[model samples]
Target: MTETKELSRLKLLAKRYARANRIAQHQALDLVAGELGFPNWNKLISVSKKGWLADSVQMASIEAFVTRALPAAIFRDGDPEAMARRFAHLEQAERGMIGDHTYRLQEILHEVIIAGEGWSIRIPENPGAIPIVETFTNQERECPALEPEFLQKALELARDRAVQVRAEISADWPRRSTKPDQSGMVRHPLCRGESDVWFCLHCDGKITSAQIAQNLWHCPACGASPLDIFDTAFWSDDKGESFLPVKTDGSTDRDELDFRIVDSRPKLDLTEEKIILLIRSALLDDATNISEKLGALQAEISVDDENGVWIIIEEDLWPEGKDPVQALAVAKLLGLEVERLSSWSTIPFAWPRLGEIASSTCDYTQMMLDAYAQYGGSPTK
Candidate 1:
């Protein structure tokens, strides 16, 4: 078929979906392409440009496959449009399948986890939302699972986006749109490093402007700090050309307290009594002010130098295994270092497993293992 005919047919399909869904024509096209084993509208068009034809057999097969493969949970709870849109994104994800390897979508988390028989890759990339994607199990990369070829491709995809977001964040934070040097070339607002060239002080890597910015002003190869970046190769054998001197007010995050806490998080000024009260409050049911809480439970809490919270509950009073777990959940949520102080705690006869949730009540998780548990079923209204 001619290009005109193919384009017309695709457009017709797009238009039909758009009208039915009350979405834009392009969005419908993207959805259609995503359903038909293509990544996006652009990808669909790219194939069409290279002599792809909209044969009835191919289109019908795709429709049939999508119908068969639809996740039942899509229509279970969320708004239909929102859930469908999310599913479309998952359908377009880059996947790798080895022996019995396949990708699975965790609908609740909106995550497409690609795993082979033994390994899986997690791209910690969301430059626009999260400033840094600092996860690496190696010396040179964020994604531990990607091979050189895959790593390069991932880098290419992430490079431009990361830099653009970082620039925006830096500029916005400084109350400026952008920063340029006296020579009219743009300098980064955060570090005032030359926009085109940089030397990583920590890893001793020479990188271009785009490369440095893409790595969030750190060494992408080594995941160094932003402070370890310099405009000149000061550690080089032969000193490089005149460096672009950076301008900055020296302000580092340091606490010179009388007694140092020295933990990952800043200390919360809660006394032992206050801590116990808070835990007790979180564990309470409908009633507040501590008087109307459940069961006669006593808590003995101690915090170590690392802020590791060790709680010895009078288990005899509480009676249920779940009561201690509820309190533990609260402590975990608060990011307090928690350990259930063992009375006979050496892997007892029964153990409660909430999976990754850290807390699950007996009332919940009664359905299928993968199913999202609905809380407080059916609103009073």
Candidate 2:
């Protein structure tokens, strides 16, 4: 049959739909034909040979039918278009109300995020993974997510969005990455590697072509991206002999939405580096003059095994017998003893007393430069 602009557009749409839904091209074409009021694609072509042109109304109707989410059950049935219309009649939405509460839906990185005023729910891309519900405020009694009806409604909305996200991801990948051939061989979208048995570098899992296709070229064991999947175990000495077969038992096609509560509260972990940073900051607070501030900035602080801190200050910058009272107080508050020591090293300038006389670093820098010029030499060569 002669192809018109509308027919070409319909073919392109069918190709896209087939890629996303993981079906054969012929099946997609038949689906398109079914939506156009034909029983099958061959019948449509046969009728078109007798001089028939689709009008704008027919074209718009077919386009609308192909674009929306169609049920997977339609592909398995004898009449795809009838089943498609049935599912479209009961369409789901991105935004809805479960009761008095309202929610909005979004998909990020193939995961669904449903959010409201002070609470949100995240449905993971993996269907086997549990959904996570989080509340922004500490008042759990007032959170709508705590209500059973609201939570279920929100979860279903998020999960529906997640399924769409997965479809988009599958559509973006190469067709072979999602559908294996009769020989159980598929190609990696990133590396373009073709093999019946694939290997995952991230988890060392041996995956079959069917398994790789089912997981959308991602490692089911570790959830690694297609970039990490290789056709051969090039890094292994035994050529994938030691690689274990990845178990996908947890993966099922059920629609059940199980959720888990996660606490995202921040916790402080005190380490040696943190203790040293605190001591250094305290030393800065103890500084009373420009020279002392410079000394504090350059001070070497370390933590000891017995909950003690050793602070080494430059003797040229810090005055002798001037104890760091603020630093000592901070250390005492942290239940740490302070041991102060002095190091005599080559100072930044020739005259150590210049910084002490000046109120700020800018003034001290000018004075030092002037002193150096008067002596017919710069601070450094």
lDDT over C-alpha atoms for residue 167 of model 2: 69
Error of 1 at 358 (Å): 42
Those runs of model 1 whose alpha carbons end farther than 4 Å from true positions after fitting are: 1-113, 124-186, 192-196, 214-227, 232-381
Q: Determine which window of 10 residues in candidate 2 has minimal summed lDDT.
A: 84-93
Candidate No. with top lDDT: 2
Model 1, global lDDT: 0.43
Q: What is the lDDT of residue 82 in candidate 1?
A: 47
RMSD of candidate 2 to the truth, in angstroms, is 5.0
Clash list (residue pairs), candidate 1: none
Model 1 TM-score? 0.23
Best by TM-score: 2
Write the residue-wise lDDT of candidate 2 on 259-289 in tens digits.
8866444557779998888888888888777
